[model samples]
Target chain A: AQSVTQPDIHITVSEGASLELRCNYSYGATPYLFWYVQSPGQGLQLLLKYFSGDTLVQGIKGFEAEFKRSQSSFNLRKPSVHWSDAAEYFCAVGGANAGGTSYGKLTFGQGTILTVHP
Target chain B: DTAVSQTPKYLVTQMGNDKSIKCEQNLGHDTMYWYKQDSKKFLKIMFSYNNKELIINETVPNRFSPKSPDKAHLNLHINSLELGDSAVYFCASSHPQVRGGYTFGSGTRLTVV
Candidate 1:
């Protein structure tokens, strides 16, 4: 089975400060990684996804994540944080199967709560 | 035009009661999924349907049943709900073959008293 772990339970950063959230996954094959953000009482919105390509993938709202196969990590980062960026973030890993039916099934990590200060 | 939408943004009911949540997608995607977000905000896949056929059924309790009337709609029905079943349920749609990311609904918060 595949699983995802997010080391940080909560992170607080001041506006204009850099931020990074850690994520690690355990999967056998090439895994599809994704980052999602969820505000209070709202559904998750996709931040970015990595199937196979450049190690650094850019996403919406000026967020990016790097896929490090050696460390089994896909860490999300932002050069500067904004107050509106405060929300719960989740990292997910998708298993690959021959039939392509497993692509939509995502195993998500325990979310990390991000708090941006003024 | 909402890409994906789920009805009943909040559902509060007593234990042992039955309830259903409806989901619909307008993005013409062929795959739809149901996910549960617990109190701690941990998300887990519960079930998936592709082209109106069941594809992935996680190790969820049998009390939780999913029905897809067509490719565009998937409804979740829980029988004899328990307090443990209280959580936010999300519906999402994606094109599996195209490697596109999922478009998620606003979510339905179910609270069993």
Candidate 2:
């Protein structure tokens, strides 16, 4: 079975400072990785996803994540933090063997709450 | 218009009561899913339906049942609700062809008293 681990439960960063959230997954084969963001009382919004190709994948809202296969990590990063960017973030992994028929059921990590301070 | 919508944004009921949460998607996607977000903010998939057919059913309690009337709608019904069942439930839809990420609803917060 696949699983995801997010090391940080909560993180605080000042505006304009760089931020990185760590995520690691345990899966057998090449996994489909995704990063999602959720505001308070709102559903999750996709930040980015990695199926294959480039190691560094850019996403919405000036966020990006790098897939490091050797380390089993897909950490989300931003060059500078904004107050509006503060939210709960989750990293997920899905099996590739699920194929088109299964539509890729995901195993999500315990979210990391980001707090951006002025 | 909302791409994905879940009715009763908040539901508060006594334990042992039964309740249902309805979800509908307007994106014309063939796949719909139900996810539970616990107090710790951990999201876990509960069930999935494709074209009104059950696809993935997680190891959730039997009290939690999902019914899909069609490809566009999936409803969750919980019986003998417990305090542990109190959490935010999310509905999502996706297009299988593009491998596009899911579009999620605002979520329904169910509180058991």
Q: How well is each residue in A1-118 modelled by candidate 1, as lDDT tens digits?
A: 8899999999999999999999999987788899999998888999999999899999999999999999999999999999999999999888566655464778899999999999
lDDT of 2 by residue, B3-93 (tens): 9999999999999999999999999999899999988887899998888989889999999999999999999999999999999999998
Local error of candidate 2 at B2, Å?
Answer: 0.8
Reference contact recovery of candidate 1: 0.60
Candidate 2 segments whose C-alpha is farther than 4 A from its true place: A98-101
Please provide, for model 2 over A1-118, each residue's C-alpha lDDT reduced to its tens digit, 9 standing for 90 to 100: 8999999999999999999999999987778889999998888999999988999999999999999999999999999999999999999887556443446578899999999999
Chain B TM-score against the true chain B, each candidate: 0.98, 0.97
* Interface RMSD, Å, model 1: 1.9
Q: Global CA lDDT of candidate 1, please?
A: 0.92
TM-score of 1: 0.96
- The per-model lDDT (C-alpha) reads 0.92, 0.91
Winner by DockQ: 1
Docking class of 2: medium
